[model samples]
Target: MLCANSAGRCEFDGCNKYIFYDNITAKKLNASNVAHIVAASPDGPRGDKTRSYLLSDKLENLMLLCPQHHKMIDDYVEDYPEELLLEMKKKHEDSIREMCDLIFVPKSERVIFFSPIKNVSLTHIDNQLTAQALLPQKRPASTCGINISIESAFDYNTSEYWSDIDNQLKRDFDRKIGNELDSDPNTIFSVFPLAPIPLIIKLGYLFMDKTNVDIYQKKRVPDTWKWIETRKTNSFSVNRIVVRAGSNIALIISLTAEINPKRVTDIVDADIIYIISAERIGVDAISSIDDLSDFWHVYQTVCDEIKNKECAVETSVFPAIPVSAAFEIGRRYMPGIYPKLHIYDDYNGFCKTLTIGGDC
Candidate 1:
């Protein structure tokens, strides 16, 4: 099933060479190699004495690859470690699974247009099937001219604006979508985000683990929109805590030592603080699994504390964390209860550019 979904292509990043080809003689040539994440032999590259006994021929330890990657990983085991290979295998398989699900699932004919931001024209959302528009109370003339009634609105300049209306937005989404889903559970949601990124992230958090929804973005091309897919899963098990520094604010727990606590504190004012040094640090980023696990533990602890109310959360990433880890943190947000994140970029010793988490 996995190989079929992959279409006989190599799973390595940026290496999509076909595994099989037809020769001029009409012969079907096979060039695929099943690469083991752990070496089959104790003396082989990335070899583990225990893994050789347990997973030497296990299918779970194998990944389909072309001859090039198979030889490359085996010859340069230190460069292509076991953990990295396992991550690659999981992502490739997940991509294939997502593609298959999209093809097999029968999507509902109804399309829900949820656009709070007043950036795109409503004509872009016109399509077959019944269409419903959810817009803000006072939007620009372009979006205001639509047939939908205004349900909500927010200030784009205010930093804490999302915090005030996060709950309202979630309730609005549930009230509207709940009735729709009751009629047809497979209804597709085509969201157009013209609001702050945090609100968009909150919109997604509302649908976490409940529905498969598609968000959309308007391209530079006039009157055009593109579908955005959510790939991160909401399932996570970790402990959370609250390091109180002040009211309605929390810090992103750092497991890497590269994040200077003093520098972070100087940039964002918060009532709560959670700080930790990395177990193993890198110059540009932290890629250690052990370190990421520690960070997740701390993140869950904080989530447990703040999963009950809307708060203004500030996160400062120092050194740097893995993209996957950051994404997992975003995915774990508990819908209406999750805080409005104020993400910062540490540039020249200042926490700059507050990016609210969202597709917009």
Candidate 2:
């Protein structure tokens, strides 16, 4: 039961190493140690006079630790205090139990796609963080997920730096993801994207409506990959200005912050304009999955607006949105129905990063 609870791995928080065998050599190895949280002996590490006797051999006071951690904690009792040890042990066991419950639950392949935002402070995606985010709804499939990393050392600000980003995405994606889709096109993809708006949108665009995708937002405040435990409701307003009939229509999404009209006006010679803004906008505006659903509902309407035109009007998308929303924008863009999109990314200034549905 103890080994099962620890999932046959070390229970020292981040040190979740497997102890079954030498993975590289394929040799049987006793790589684990049964360590007492409150020492079985009174004078041992974290030993207590009364509690040591009470908890000796008790499952509650034991942890499945690797040999190294077992020795290190014994060596320095101060650093690995009783309370901290118990916390680690409890968290590890509870997490393991929760994971066990999800053995039969649906699995989602963690699709990781990221690029540098502002050419600084790139975010790292680990199974530890993404695993915590996947609970209650899906099981973490890190071992089998699709990973396509496109973090160029080149400056994101320079137009020349991004010329081949789409091509690279296609090449890597076709090599890894396209083959997977050919076998099982219905595979559920849990996308964790932290890239420029254009690339994420393109990522979503590539997936299209044909593929199943779950977008995970990286929250700014708590700095977590998990969705809010409870859904927080938000309200949005869609305002449109149809100046005159023309070949271009401007679709401006201002969710995180407001985008000045002049920025779009200077670049796009549009006859019609549509603005989708939240009642309250900020980094935390998109806090729940329901909020994304709300955006999707609004998004379909926007897509229909473009699709129903007498002639295919080219769409200019100027976005001030969270990464998740940008992705959805791409996912929903159907070539035959929706017009071509000239997606603008904010760097030093708005430079066209990608074009969706341009060919068809």
Candidate 3:
């Protein structure tokens, strides 16, 4: 096979020809020279035949460059010292670090907060399924706006159509609902640090619950029910949340009306745990609250519950403390929130942009 390093076009400034092999043998003629995708010797030219970086011959690591950039690096080597080269390498490494942690949130130990699930509660809509356990017993007079769940909606074969729905939801939310809230993309869309555990795993055995879910994107709502035409098996639960490198972190707040004690006890199984960065619930729509403030509010609420009534709910946050704040916390729990996280190396390219529960 052709040497991958010499097979490609050069990225070095002002270079345009194919790069040659490294050996510089006489049989091949004295025509071409090797260019490093990353630099080797600072004193040498860009594609200097004399030098080799650590990434020289690995197929995924090499690049080809013409002679011009080779000369430029040779001339500029003194000005661009080793420190500068090292800094550049670190910058690229930092870019792809996926700031997410994925672990199973057993149904028994997940956090639950008390708040109206919708912005405007309609009695006519309330009457439709009021008898089921899924609906909240009493609707609050205030609105909680909308909850965005990036739960898995479909499989790979269904990807094209479902993605269209996802896009439409995004557009509708941005153009209409976000405008009314005075929110920009940064405020409306965020990374939910904790991912949902697969429903099959939580059920613990072969069981079924039929319910309706109204999917919301911004303000547009679409109704979906689980029991009508589909089935779930015990074997279907998944253990990981797909996260991509460098996505906005979202602190997912999952609320369930009925208190289940076993859920809180399941915190031990989580692979990544996070603290409440911030929270905002039960506030007026006009509050203009940010996510961090929202996190704090939720944190306070949890503390109050623990102090007074002893709520069984527990919270797990992820990506550990931000890299920027390592010194202050030093990998310790903010309070006694149990089951803290062990920060793994940033996620690989396998990271996903959204968390999709395996159900649909």
Top TM-score: which candidate number? Answer: 2
Taking all chains together, the TM-score of candidate 1 against the true structure is 0.33
Q: Write the per-residue lDDT of candidate 2 for residues 167-212, one digit (tens) a residue.
A: 7887887887788788888777888887788888888888888887
Model 2 RMSD to the real structure?
5.8
lDDT by residue (268-349, candidate 1, tens digit) is 6544554443434432122333334455666666654554442444343332433334434544555445455555533345
Ten contiguous residues minimizing lDDT sum, candidate 2: 305-314
lDDT-wise, the better of 1 and 3 is 1
* Candidate 1 error regions (>4 Å): 1-105, 109-164, 186-190, 221-224, 227-360
Clashes of each: 17, 2, 25
Give Cα distance to truth, residue 78, candidate 1, Å: 80
RMSD after CA superposition, every candidate: 19.5, 5.8, 23.6
Cα lDDT computed for each candidate against the true fold: 0.51, 0.81, 0.28
Query: Where is model 3 poorest over a 10-residue stretch in terms of lDDT?
Result: 106-115
How does each model score on TM-score?
Answer: 0.33, 0.73, 0.20
Candidate 3 lDDT tens digits, 1-360: 123323343434334344543344524333444434445553343344444455456433333335675455446867544344344333433322311111121111111111111122222222122112122322211223233233323432243423543454355445543463463322221111112112111111111111111111111122311112122211101122324332222222222111122332242243222233212222111122232233334444543443344332332322222211221121122323422222211122111221121222
The CA lDDT at 331 in model 1 is 44
